[model samples]
Target: MARLTALAGGLAVALVLLAAPAMAHNHPSGITDLVTPAVVRVEATAHVDITLLDHIGELVHVERSYDVPIGSGTGIVINPEGGIVTLTRVVKTDRDVAVYAANRVFAEHHKVKIPADFARHKLKDDVLNHHLQECYPPKTPTATCIINVTTNITVFPNVSPADPKGLKADLVKAGDTLDSPAVLTLSGRVLGSLGMPTAPLADKVPDAAGSPTNVAGFLGRPAPNLPFTVDIAHLRQGGGGDSQGRQFADPEKKVDEPVKLGKLIDEGFLGAPVIGDKDGHVVGMLFGGGQDGRMIGVREITAALAKAGVAPRRGAIDSAFEAALTRYHTKYYTEAASGFQRVLELYPGNVVAAGLLKISLQKRGTAEDAGTKGAVSPTPRSLPLWPFIVAAAVLLVAALVGAFLLWRRRAPEERVEEPPAPVATASPQQPFDEGANPTVVVRRSQPFQVVPRQQPLMTANEQPSVKYCTECGMRLGPAHRFCGYCGHPIET
Candidate 1:
């Protein structure tokens, strides 16, 4: 059953946000404050001013009138424009007896015989019935023959009779006469109204643990089961006066339920708001039926408002807060956080929003850090990274250059002079004989390019030229001491 108790709204937020161990017991959130302004203790005073009439239904001289308190009843404002819902009897002054009283006085004023009516009326004057009728006609009737007509209804709101906020409500459509839901509206009216909750409470199955399982997946996020329970209670009093019939309770529902109102509400508290405990939403209204009372659900209240041609709408803060609360239950921590922040912006210092926001932030932080304990922390925004990166790059380039220069510095310094070109040992004075034998031409055995060894102060072309080995037909390298391939002793 949706029978929930009324709690402070802040407490409800805390209950949803706090951990299980930290919140050992349910705390008061004072959520009713949200509904307090909407809820009103209605003290209605109905007055009737009587005048006499003649036998022909013509008005006669005025008779003694009455201006007295009829009764009190509570009512819910369905619209910020003054649309309210209450018992039909509260707003409707059943002056049927007053009608009879006026007629009796008319009979006596005309000096006509009194019919067999249950009540008698005092005579207005000694005028005869027909004479008074002749003297006072419809519009042309004399002032003395005017019909008795006067009724005043005054509604006192949250304040008592002494409070200045007393508002006079007008009867738009009396349920007693229309057989529809009873409704009312105050003079000053209400500035805002609570929007009805559209979603029904789906029956939840509990997991192996006793808590309900959150089977609904909320946009790829883990849905947390709402750990809060609905609180229910009724405001009741015992006294005398015309009592407004209370709303009917669920016939099959058992009494003693926290939400089921078993006691009779005195007439004064009839229309007072029946606030929910946890969310402070109106679970139902305290309506008078008989000895038992029932709260009107959001659906019924909505319907009644519709019938009255008034739409039940939500204010800015209430709308955002409710949306956030819904997201919180589904464990949409990020979205809920944004929603709560929006509400806070709209209504600063909103306790419910603040508490819920803290919860949302905490949950979001935990979700983000779930497995990132060893991960790197984010860099501070105050420092720019580009400068540091550039510095590192410069250091790397300098290190490479330093290594290259150090190798050059460690290179050999002493140069061995080539020994005097080994004497060709007169390739045998045979050369002199060969010269006479034929015009012989000397050519290089191995093709070679001239290579030069240069000091730091010299250029490649300015270095000393290398000579080839005269004995083994091989090219020489810088400072070579022997022929590497031929195993011959090098001259230089």
Candidate 2:
């Protein structure tokens, strides 16, 4: 029974041991941790020649537009090729693209305009189409606005921004295009000029991730970090709860998904990439602010860029990372931990993976303690010493408890009884002739008498016979009629 108990206890302990490793697995990125790195702050400064009053109140023309900052908004890198997608309102000629990639800020980038189709709203007889050209900047040449234009829709990705790879794109096909309302449509160029009708957007293909069904085919796939959702206030410090930065402000026209948000950002965040909380996938490029803010979805953005002769792809690292993310979402912590470790190995600078791995390790202990979870992997070749120690402790406790109960059960039998008090009696006869009063005496108890096993003595309580001698308390044989000690008389 003792052996069986030990065996059962060890088995239970082993099961308990399995839970620690699982608990140690990595944690998935939460809403805040995932999105912080990918987000970028875009600052565009432009000079517009303006007519202004001089210090003496005389009319004067200023060549530099330094005082007026051209455009301020947000943008996110959409493709590995360095294609940055933002609201078109932020980009203009003479505008400088300053990007804040986390802490590493890049001062200047070539501004490129995304390809979009705009429908110009015009009245009869060619009156001023004031309503249709809202996207066009004030400096856009009037001669180029010969054609009426209205709505603008994102149909393709701008394959080029200032190339982070330091490669300049070769010129492609050039022609006039009325597609964009912001452009001088009649001349197929900005300000009625002829050349590439759009800003140089296509330079090279973005690194494409293989199809979701066939992830293994891709080579050197880039792993996008998991994304998060945070309150607009959390991103900035010391703005009122209700008030936010203009860049993060809600747009006047809110449209549809791909860019749908729980709450609108200030104006600065308008063009920021809306990343998914799950896989860190770019859901859309944010724009618009009506009832529903609009975003260009990943598929549509990439697909349009594909039509526009730009390659769009996801990297292998992204695939692996996303698989790990799936495991984490399903609570397969052990696998997720391994996955996150792999990501860190691939890219040590990946903060999201590191954070997640730390969380996984911390949760593993808790899960193991709860007994509801255990490790998924096989046991290691060498067991940890802790398990053995735990088992030994458990067994020791069991032994101690058993000993205590056994002692309690045998206590009565082991107890010693006081022998009956001795009666007064005359001394052996030393003082009988000296006028001695009856001498009193106390006798010590005799040693316990033992009958050998071979002798086969019956217990006094078991036998009905009065076998003990009443006189002098001597042992008596069953057939004896006389006391053996003190010569006391006895009846058979």
Candidate 3:
């Protein structure tokens, strides 16, 4: 009983020890909870000029259109006017920029003229046709429509200015130093852009000082989206040069170190938000393909946007924008376009959703045209079923034949062959008289018998038992009353 009790106690202790680590590992951190809401997928469609260097030392420039998609990157809603504060690199464009708000609302160019006949046809199908008819004109046989046209595109959120409490505005009448970072508010919540509270190096930094930092970004072409991230070892102050200056000056150099983001958040976290450890504020964006992983600070992001003469704006259309984005991800382009259009109706200045909406509308239009064409097309004739039936019949006949042949080959040999009868020899010739019946004499063979020959009788002084049987010279049984073969009796 004592041994059993000790064994049970040990097992209980072991189980408790095993469960402790799992509970700790599964506990969600403050950073993950805080930044998940602000994370948004930035989807862009742009024409990238590809330059190829051939073996012959000739450079070929190819202008190809590509859809760029960035998923689950950290972003901030700066204001109620639908302005979003995200990494400029996240929305950078050689040709165009489109934003997919957290609510899935799309901001894109919507000023295209819609033909009367096309609009009427689309409206006949559904109210959602407005999105398609407005952006893509039906192609006429006489005049081919150019589907891919290079347009200067910009996107912004439609944030209403009336929300007093959420609105954050820097009150600079005419001449203010504007030394500190600007703060904006939306829905009465004060918002800060990437550059707001810059991260500074702490004291007592080690000689070989570098801390793990997460970088997230979108990879591959946008049509089929691929998102990924990398962890980088952020160096101390003046260790690997300033994070701000080094990133822009040498984007290639930062791609050379292996990033260790601890075991908890490692691979498959591409395009994940990287938040500040102190306040859980988003401070950087990550891109894949760097040895240590590529990351750009908030300062660099804001600076890039300033260069492009654009600022982050979040507005009333944000909810609708996010909804459209969700629809797009779900592959409901029709619904997505409607959602994007609702956003546009609310905020006409949102270029991100406007551009994406144009593409979505075009896709929807083409799909409708294809569907109509398929409906009008003739049904093809199917081949006769007789061929299959005939083949099956032939196979059945062949199987029957094979079975019969197999049975014939395996038949018993005794059943197939019979032995010949023996011929009889003529008896002694006794047929001299032809008239009288001939009588033939036959000799019978002697029966097999054991006859005992006479043997000398033993005297009283001698043994009475016989040494062996006289007929067959065989030994007698131990307690035999008579010989087994000839009936000769023997004394015990």
The sequence of per-residue lDDT tens digits that candidate 3 reaches over residues 291-399 is: 3444444564455445434455434445666667555544346776888898667655344566668767776634332223333321232233444445555555565
- Candidate 1 TM-score versus the reference: 0.39
RMSD for all candidates, in order, please. Answer: 20.5, 20.9, 30.4
TM-score of each: 0.39, 0.33, 0.26
Per-residue accuracy of model 1 over 242-332 as CA lDDT, tens digit each: 2332233223344442233333344244444555444454544445534555443444555566676765544655567677766665555
lDDT agreement with native, every candidate: 0.44, 0.36, 0.36
State residue 140's C-alpha deviation in candidate 3, in Å: 26
Q: Write the per-residue lDDT of candidate 2 for residues 1-492, one digit (tens) a residue.
A: 455557666766776676555445444432333333233334433322322212223333322122234443444433334334444454332322111110011001112222222222233322222322322333344321122211211111111121122212211111121110011011111111111111112222122221110000001112233122233211111222111211122222333321333234333445555444334344444544443344434444444454446444444445556666566655556777888888666544454567677777665545422222564433343245566667666776776677668778986766444333223343342212222111112223444443321222445554434455576665544434454333344554
Model 2 whole-model lDDT (C-alpha atoms): 0.36
Which candidate ranks first by TM-score, i.e. highest? 1
Model 3 misplaced regions, further than 4 Å = 1-30, 47-77, 85-148, 151-208, 212-273, 304-492
Candidate 1 least-lDDT 10 residues = 212-221
